[model samples]
Target chain A: MITDFTPWQSLGGGALIGLAAVLLMALHGRILGATGILGGVLRFADMDDWRLKAALLVGMAMGPLVLLALTGQTPAVEIPISTLAIVLGGVVVGVGVSYGGGCTSGHGVCGNARFSRRSLVATVTFMVTAFATVYLTRHVMGV
Target chain B: MKLVSALLIAVIFGIGIALSGMMNPAKVLNFFDLAQIGAGTWDPSLAFVMGGALAITIPGYWLVFRRAAPLQAPRFQLPDTKVIDRRLILGSATFGIGWGIAGFCPGGALPALGTGEPEAFLFVAALIGGLLLARALETRGLRSKPAI
Candidate 1:
């Protein structure tokens, strides 16, 4: 049983995300959704976003390097799952986004602001599902 | 110019996710661990992140909405679909399972590449595969729908 509150870091990071979202919408008239952005670009010749999307991806990839250079440290990440689980999970998420139309950024962040009923519903649905999943895995299955 | 600006914004976003600790899968998975839901062990940092993001984006979006169009682009491009059908529910449920299992959603997953995590590479690759396959199916469905 442990609880930690990193108020400044969380708040600062979140504000940056908000700023990026706002800038994306303001400047490009696009949503700051990673899934939609990447997915749209992966569609071969059908995408008009190849160039910009490639640049955005490059920037995202470089973000940590910049952070590491500035802070001289990287955040700790522990993924306690096998490669198989990760692969399966990623594929499942892709299929889910295909069906639901978006994920956290698209629905949770952008869609909510737009006051879209679909986003609201989608957000609630995923949150509940996430809660239930953890409960079942941690409590019931003990896995 | 657009590419450079997009790169800058994405860099900022990626750094934000890293600084916020959202880039860590364990941090997010811990939040989803409902075994501590009622207990004091629950991590609420994600809430602060969500609140902070929404605090600025909400008003910022509205201000832009008031504008006839975007500052640089021709017009605002917003989603319009509103149906709450089975696809939405089932898809979200499926996504939740994967997220709960891995604690890495799309946004959380991508920026980890910046951190050079080996595991992130696998997840991103698999996600891309899923998206490509599903998109192929989606287009096929659309193409065949008219015939049926």
Candidate 2:
């Protein structure tokens, strides 16, 4: 119930994400999917590919550092859920992304942008489930 | 060049995630909580984030895909399969449950790791564990198809 409607920041941040995805596609001919990249690193299908994926993760880790350097403050992050919930949710997400072939970044952003039918289906499927899960947990069970 | 560019792109992506307030699980949960919409407390920031990204990417993809190849790679690596298999739906549904539970999607969680929070690391570690477990199942001929 307590959520900030940050339209400007959300839009700006989204544009940056779009720019990153576009650059990845334009420069490297690869989709800028976060989970896929991480999965590649874990899979280690090829040494060269592994290195590229690792570098992207490193960049992800460096994001807060860069923000700190520019603004002298680390971005605030809040995790309201319990440890048990976090781990449980994390595992589910991992398996789901693995089985589903993509996550929010891949299917929701880049795939949708490319007008891929599969991506659209994947996106809708996840969104519907997410909505249902939230409804059940917060309203039905109140957990 | 590819590694450097990939890193830069990730940084941009991470910053965007952080700036969009997606790093905050509470905010994400609020967005997922559709019941709040009628009460007038639903946060629509996530939608704006998607909208803003699409605003740029829709045209960007249209222009970029027109070329024969990318700047570095020999061919554009895209999803080849068009099949809407049961695995896709089931897997996505599973992920949706998790997303709703914690409000931490993979992309959002990455930037959150910078917060130096144990919760973030724990979630990521569990996520990796889940990935490995799924891969193990795939190896055993249980789950089919490679993730994108």
Candidate 3:
């Protein structure tokens, strides 16, 4: 059985997200768009520009680590996928970030909040594709 | 520095994920897989994540927009068009398919991958493929219609 979902936890998460977005805007004068950050890193002209990208990526990686440290709960399941598949997944997401002009964080969070038509379209596209893929993979492919 | 700010934001975002239980991929997968399992209860963690995000963003946007000159750029760059055409529907469908299969969206996937989940990586790969295909099509479309 799946563990119970907690409202407090959800609210806490939302608050953190909102705060992060706000802080990014207030301090950096930028939206918290993950895709843009990654893209900038990949296409950066100056090596110094990569600093921000690295910082952002590192923070993302560290967030859960910190939580795990506090809670001491082990990850529930291990995906039995290969390393190649993992790399391929990253590449695919990178391409999507480029094609959509943003990732879920950019479009789904910042863009959607700002009422950006492009972001809305992109977010919708992302969600729909995700849903379909899940259905096919789990239901039809049974993988 | 911008790097510092980026790191700060990422950490805060991570904290939010931890608070909301989104860090648990199993829970996320269960939400998508609702079969064989009992009628799942609402995971309010998502709501908190959304609410918390909005709480900060709503006022934050107001402040940024109010500024005469944005720190990074000349003016706020907002999208010009709002048409819900074929691109919107098609892209959305594709994205949904991916999400449903993998039980992870890009935003969620990033954090999950950060946790060193192998499956998350695979999902990310497929996501990139879809993205690339979309981009190529978009570029082609742009070329076909110079006015756009």
Candidate 4:
């Protein structure tokens, strides 16, 4: 049984995410939704919002970087899909986030945390679609 | 006291992810495939992670809800609607499909990317694209509402 259970590590990771989200909300009045933050960068709207957006993006990018620096652990598995396929996946997710009005962090973390009905619906939709897709990809198409 | 407590709770949440191996993309990807291969051989590590998270969060939620004033937000924000509709169903379906194919949902994926997996980057990109398109459509709909 090669089970990996590290309560301290997991707790630390979750704490970072929660702290980031909380700080972003408190300081910037924006939820730490990665999708939204990335979208803002791509669109490059008014100048006023740029600083906060940039900060959030850096914070996200830095979170993992900092962890790597401390732990020195790297990913083992090679992604099976092509770069094109991966980018296509990104586009699909982007479209979904747009229509849903929130990404997983917004809907799953903050909105759901607030117990918003819309967030609940969105989160469930996200989860179910993900399950079905994985099943089909791995089982049916053997991707 | 409320703000301090919220921050402390947030720290606990981060620690849980770090300890549970949920921060690792490979581990998470494996969990999604567990049902297909056979639960017997599946890695139950994340299950314990989930359990621990729930154990901590359930009580946390209860304590926070019991408060007269929200610690973080200006007021307590609870779900306003219980009705399920087409938007809910459709959105959920789309989200699940994406998660299944990618093996990364928004919350877990970003943190797991700390492992420097390129796939995580790809996932984040696709997620952003989906969100932007949705927003565009919404803006269009709002504009045409009065005309219709």
* Candidate no. 3 TM-score: 0.74
The superposed Cα distance between candidate 1 and the true structure at residue B79, in angstroms, equals: 1.4
lDDT of 3: 0.60
Model 1's CAPRI class is medium
lDDT of 3 by residue, A13-98 (tens): 77787778767766666667766664555545767657766687688767777767878753343342344534554554544455
The DockQ ranking, best first, is 2, 1, 3, 4
What TM-score does each of the candidates earn? 0.92, 0.97, 0.74, 0.68
- Residue A115 of model 4 has an lDDT of 61
Error of 4 at A5 (Å): 6.5
Better of 1 and 3 by DockQ: 1
Give lDDT for model 1: 0.78
Best by lDDT: 2
Taking the tens digit of each residue's C-alpha lDDT, what string does model 1 give over A1-143? 24365778888888888888899999989888887877766745644478777877878777788888989986666786667878888887877776777888888888887778888888898888887887887789876
Docking class of 4: acceptable
Q: Which parts of model 4 have CA positions greater than 4 angstroms off?
A: A1-8, A26-29, A43-46, A74-78, B1-25, B34-39, B44-85, B107-123, B135-148
Whichever of 1 and 3 has more lDDT, that candidate is 1
Predicted candidate 3 versus true structure: per-residue lDDT over B6-110, tens digit per residue: 786788787676566555554554455544245544333454566567676767787777877656544554445566655444444444444443445556665
Which DockQ value does candidate 3 get? Answer: 0.44
| Candidate models: Cα lDDT each | 0.78, 0.88, 0.60, 0.53
Whichever of 2 and 3 has more lDDT, that candidate is: 2
Q: What's the distance in Å from true for residue A30, model 1?
A: 0.5
| Interface RMSD for all numbered candidates | 2.9, 1.2, 4.3, 5.8
Tell me the spans in candidate 3 whose CA falls farther than 4 Å from its real position.
A1-3, A46-49, A68-97, A128-143, B33-38, B41-48, B70-89, B121-148
Q: How do the residues B71-133 of candidate 2 rate in per-residue lDDT, one tens digit apiece? A: 988989998989888988999899899999988999988878877878888888988988888
